[model samples]
Target: MKLFQKLTPKALIFWTIGDQAGKVYLGILGNLILIFAIFEPAKINYARVLINS
Candidate 1:
């Protein structure tokens, strides 16, 4: 009911973050690497991708 609806978003966000931690880390790493490799971007590591799936 209303309680379920209220918790849905929090639960979803938690699960999504948990599931995609690696992907997010890799994506950020890739982005930072590409930037440095091509455009001399900053060296940044570790990332948290938010997924709503």
Candidate 2:
């Protein structure tokens, strides 16, 4: 139970950071596709994002 308590916050923080990073990643990806019409670059990123999510 002590080990679980120690890890819980660390796990929560790690997940929060990961969530924020994914949001920023998708925002950039959206800008590229919408503003620049750059599908090639986003396609690569999209694949990785899909794998992650």
Query: Best candidate per TM-score, number?
Result: 2
Count of backbone collisions within predicted model 1: 0
**C-alpha TM-scores of all predictions:** 0.39, 0.54
lDDT (Cα, tens digit) per residue for candidate 2, span 1-53: 77666777879789889999999999999887786666677887999999999
Tens-digit lDDT string for candidate 1 (1-53): 87667767879788788779978999999999887797543222222222322
Task: In model 2, state the lDDT of residue 24.
Answer: 100
Leading candidate by lDDT: 2
* Least accurate 10 contiguous residues by lDDT in model 2: 32-41
Off by over 4 Å in 1: 1-17, 41-53
Give, for candidate 1, the lowest lDDT window spanning 10 residues: 44-53
How many pairs in model 2 have backbone atoms within 3 A of each other, for residues 3 or more apart or on separate chains, i.e. clashes? 0
Computed on alpha carbons, the lDDT of every model, listed in order, comes to: 0.70, 0.85
**Candidate 2 residue 17 C-alpha distance from true site, Å:** 0.1
